[model samples]
Each structure stands twice: as C-alpha cells, then as structure tokens.
Target: MSIIVQNISKSYNKAKAVEAITFEVKEGELFGLIGPDGAGKTTIFRILTTLLLANEGSAIVAGFDVIKDYKAIRDSVGYMPGKFSLYQDLSVEENLTFFATIFGTTIEENYDLIKDIYIQIEPFKTRRAGVLSGGMKQKLALCCALIHKPKVLFLDEPTTGVDPVSRKEFWEMLKRLQQKGITILVSTPYMDEAALCDRIALLQKGSILKIDSPENIIKNYDKVIYDVRTQNMHQLILDLKNYPSQYSVYAFGEYIHYIDKSAGFNPKDLAAYLEKNKHSEIEINISRPTIEDVFMDL
Candidate 1:
C-alpha cells in the first residue's frame, strides 16, 4: 500500500470531525473518497499530509509514519488542498517555479510530469494566480503540486467548481499521471465522479459506508430502483413517503428514485396511487442503481 490508515480519529475542541476511519491506497492507483460536504474528507487529508494530528490511531504514507516521519512524508507526497493555497500574488509560471525551486529542483527537471496539464494554461502563465478563471486556477494548482514530482498525490475536491470541459480534462490528466506510478487519493462530493476512480470509499458524517471498485459497489446494491416523476414533484414526494411500500425515496436529477419495500411492486399501482393524490403526467420506470443510490442506501 502506498497509504495506510488505521482507526484514525480527529476532533476540534469538543466535536469530533472524523472517527475510527481506516482505508488504504495502493501504489499507482486512483482512490476516491466520495461523499457530500462535512464528511471529514478534508480532515483526513490534513492528517495524512502531516498538516494536522489525529487524537488516536495511526497513518503511514509512502513508507513513512505520518507522526514519526512527517518531514519525509511531506517530501514524498504532493498535496493540493480543497481551497487554493498557492501564493495568489504570484503568476502561474512563478508559482510553479517557486515550488520546484523550494523542492531543490528546477522546472526543467520535472517538466514532463506537468507538461500535459501545464500546456493547457501555458499561455496564461503570466496571469496572477488570483485573477485566473476557476478552471485555469485548478490547472495551475495541480501543476504546482506536481512540480516536486512526489510519489504520492492527494487532491482535495480538485474539480468542485470547475466547468464540465475542464473537469473532464482534469480526470484525463490523472489517468496519465497514474501511468508514471504516482499514487493518487482524491475526494469529491459529486457521486458521478466516483466511477472515474480505480476504487472508492463512500464516506458520510465521518463514517465509511462502503469501499470497493465502482462496479462492485453498484453490483452489490440489492434494491430494485425506479425513476418516478409527476406533475407536482413536491406533492409526489410527500405522498410516496407515506406510502406503505416505499423503502426509500430521494430526488435524483429531474426525477425521484424510489425503492419499494415490497418485492412484487407494480408500476400501474403506483401510477394509480399518484392519480388519486391529484398528480398528473405520472411517470415511473425501472431504473439502474448508481453510486448515489448506493450512498443513500447505506
């Protein structure tokens, strides 16, 4: 394992942020921590990168203990925080150069490591870090983190506010990086992005719900799901929640995903039930389980 965490826990003042957390990331693998906000992903990142200490348990990164070998871990791992933490006053090139220099290396030495991503914003290299667009800033941040050519990389929600095009490009860059044997651990709130990782740990409120390959997670989902929509979405949810057959009901995109407690559920019965509730254009269809469904089920 490139990264090993065993029953790690952290607390702020009195409230616990992450509790009894444990997971591992293999060398050259892309592992994702998937969940919504306040899930303790950032807290775990801080602990693993040696920026913060855990009240209990232990963590090892790149063959070094987080507590006993923090300096070595810092030298061997690249960390891109959830929020942009680079010098905002520095230009893109200047920021990259500064990081490379501080690491006792020149940009030319690690040019190949960041060539693909840096090229995207090379024209804006002279632009101040604070003034660049969200996507450009993300690319520059990634470049700066990779400038040191570390063995392990930790990216904290790197594409949260980025555009779709840039987000796609960013994942592509990660795929390329893995080829060079750099282990990557990333966290994101978007359930859709879970599929991009080699394996993912579904996190919520500081607890891990599941950890497996994306396909395996979906395959293990035992519920028969349905995509349901009605003329009045709000009323439809209320009626469904009260329905005796409902196992779970949650909004997904333009429709609501419904799982019934009854195995022999019939669509016609649901349609009729909605009609009685004064809902129009009621639509219900069998649907596949997604990463979000897996998270919600747990």
Candidate 2:
C-alpha cells in the first residue's frame, strides 16, 4: 500500500476531528476520501502528508513514518491543499519555477510529467495567478505540486468551486497522472465524483461508515428504492414523510428518491395515493442505487 492509516485520531480543544479510523490505499491507485466538510478527510490527508501531528495512532506514506520520517515524507509527497496556497502575485510560469527551485529541480526536468496539464495553461504562463480563471488556477496549482515529481499526490477537494467544464477537465488530468503511476489521494464532497475512485472511505462525523469500490458500495445498497416525481416536490416530501408507510424520502436531482417502510411496497399504490391527493403529472418508479444513495444509507 502507498498509504496506510491505522486507528489515527486528531482533535482540537474538545472536538474530535478524526476518531480512531483505519483504511489503506494501494500504491498507484486513485483513492478517494469521500465526505463533506468537517468529516475529517482533510485531517487525515494532513497527517499522511506530515503537515499535522495526529493526537493518536500512526500512518505511513511512501514507505516513511509520518513522524520519524517527516522530512522524507514531505520530500516524497505533493500536497495541494483545499485552498489555493500558491503565490498569487506571481505569474504562472514564475510560480512553477519557484516551486521547482524550492524542491531543488527545474521545470525542464519534469516538463514531460506536467506537459499535458501545463499546455492547457501555457499561453497564460505570464498571467498572474490571482487574475486567472478558477480552472486555470487549479491547473497551475497542480503543476506546481507535480513540479517536484513526488511519488504521491494529495489533493484536498480540488474540484470545489470549479465550473462543471473545468471540473471535468481537471479529473481528466488526474486520470492521465494515474496512468503515469503516481498514487493519488483525493477528498471531495461531490458524490458523483466518488464513482471515479478505485476505493473510497465514506467518512462522516469523524468516522468511516464504509469503505469499498464504488460499484460494490452501490451494489450492496439493499433498500427497495424508488424515484418519485409529482406536481409540488416540497409539499410531496412533507406529505410522504407524514404518510404512515414511508421509510425515507428526500429530493434527489429532479426526482424525489424514496423508500417504503411497508414491506409489500407497490409503486402503483403510491401513484394512486398521490393522484387522489390532487398531485398531477405524478411519476414514481424504481431506480438503481447510486453512490449518493449508498452514502445516505451509510
């Protein structure tokens, strides 16, 4: 495994950020730390990258201890924090050069590694980091992080706030990097992106609810789920929740995803009830389980 975390925990004052959770990522695997904000994903990345000390437990990254081998860990890993920390005042080319210098290397040395990502932003190499678009800044940050040619890359919510097109482009870049055999550990709140990972740890409230391949996780969702649509979504949710036979009901995308407490669930019965309640254009049907559904079930 490229990253191994065992019973690691971290806390601030009295609030525990991470609680004795354990998981591993095989080398060269595109692993995702799946969770929303305050779910302890960032804390785990910090410990593995040797930025923060864990209050308890231990971790290893790239064959080095996080504590005893802190320096080596720092040297072998590229960490792109949730927030952009690159020098904003500097131009794109200058920023990359500076980071390379700090790592005792130059852009020419790793040009082949970052060429694909850099080419998209090369025309704006002279532009200051602050003036670039959200996507451009993302690419530059990735370039700097890879300038050192580290074996492992840690990206914390790299797609948040990015435009849909840019987010798609950025993920494509990650796939290319993975092909080059660099291990990636990424964290994100976007459930749709979870399907792209080889394996994921579903973190919530500082604990892991499950860890498995995206397919396995969704396949293991045993609920009798349905996609429901009606004239008024808001009122329908309230009405469904109040219904004596409803188990779980929440709006998902353009459809309301629901489950029934009644074992002998019948979609026709639900449609009839809604129709009787004056809900026109009602649409209710069974749907496949998605990563989001699995996460909610967890």
Candidate 3:
C-alpha cells in the first residue's frame, strides 16, 4: 500500500474532527476521498501528510511512519493544500525554481515530470503567482508540487473553485502522472469527479460510509430511486417526504429523488396521491443510482 490509515481520530477542544477513520491507497493508483465540505477529508489529509497528529490510530505514507518518520514522509510526498500556499510575490518560474531548490533539485532535473502542465503556464512564467487566473494558478501549484517527483501526491480539493475546463484538464494530468507510478490521494466535494478515480471512499460527517470503485459503489446500492418532479419544486419535496412509503427524500438537480420503504410500492399510487394533492405535470420515473445518491442514502 502507498498509504495506510488505521483507526485514525482527531479533535480540537473536545469536538471530534474525525473518529476511527481508516482506509488505504494502492501504489500507483488514483484514489479519491469523496464527500462534501466538513466531511473530515482535510483533517485526514493533514494527518496523513504529518502536518497534524491524530489523537488516536496510525498512518503510513510512502513506506514511512507518519509520526516517527515525519521528515522522510515529508520528503517522499508532495502536498498541495486546499488553499493556495505558494509564494504570491514570486513569478511562476521563480515559484517552480524555489520549490525545486527546497527539494534539493533543479527544474532541469525534473523537466519531463512537469513538462505537460508547465507548458500551459510557461508563456506567463514572468507573471506573479498572486495575479494569475484560478486555472493558471492551479497548474502552477501542481507543477511546483511535482517538481520534486515525489512517490506520493496529496491534493486536497484541488478543483474546488476552478472552472469546468480546468478541472477536466487537471484530472487528465493526474491520470498521466499515475501512469508513471505516482500514488495520488485526492479529496473532492464534487461527486461527479468520483467516477474518474480508480476507487473512492465515501465519507460523511467523521466516518466512511463506503469504499470501492465508483462502479461497484453504485452497483451495490440496494435502492430503487425515482425521479419525481412537479410544478412546485419545494412543495414537491415536502409532499414526498410526508408520503408514508418514503424511505428517503431529497432534492437532486431538478427533481426529488425518492426511495420507497414499502415492499410492494407502486409509482401509480404515488402519481394518484400527487394528483389528489393538486400537483400538475407530475413526472416520476425510475432513475439510475449515482455516487451522490449513495452518499445521500448513507
């Protein structure tokens, strides 16, 4: 395993950030910690990267213990924090060089590692890091993280504020890096992005709900969801929640995803009930389960 976290727990002033959290990442695999904000993803990242100690449990990163071998782990892994932390006063080239220098290496030594990503920003190499656009800054941050060619890379919500095109490009770059045997552990709130990873851990609150390939996660979900919508979206949700057979009810995009608790439930009965309630243009159809659906169910 490239990363191993066993029963890790952390808290601040008696409030638990994560409790008994556990997972592993295979070498050369692209793994994701999939969840929304405040799901303890960042706390796990900080623990695994040795920035903060867990209140309980152990973790290993890149073949070294996170605590006893903190220095080695720091050297062996590249960390790109959720917030941009690069020197804003430095130009793009300067930032890359500075990171490379800190790692006791040079740009020429690892040019091949960052060539693809760096090329996108090389034309603006003279611009200060603070003034670059979000997408450009993202690429530069990634290049800086990879300048050392570490065995493992930790990206915490790397695409949170990025545009759709840049987010797509960033994931593609990660796929290329994984091909070179760099283990990647990334966290993201965007459920759609979970499908891109080789495997993902679904986290909520401070616990892991499920961990498997995106296909398996969806395939194993034992729920038949229905997409229900009407003229009034808010009222539609309230009505569905009040339905006696409702197992779960929540808004999904333009529709309300509803799961029935009754064994012999029928959509016709639901439509009849809605019609009686004065709802018009009722549309209810069997919908495919997705990562978000599974998370919401959990």
Task: Write down the TM-score for model 2.
Answer: 0.98
lDDT of each: 0.93, 0.92, 0.95
Models sorted by lDDT, best on top? 3, 1, 2
- Model 2: per-residue Cα lDDT over 211-241, one tens digit each: 9999999887889888999889988888788
Clashing residue pairs found in predicted model 1: none
The TM-scores of all predictions, comma-separated, are 0.98, 0.98, 0.98
Between candidates 1 and 3, name the one with more favorable lDDT: 3
TM-score: model 1 vs. ground truth: 0.98
lDDT of 2: 0.92
lDDT of 1 by residue, 149-268 (tens): 999999999999899999999999999999999999999999999999999999998988889999999998888999999989998889999888899999999999999999788989
Model 1 C-alpha lDDT versus the unseen true structure: 0.93
Which residue pairs come into collision in candidate 3? none
Best by lDDT: 3
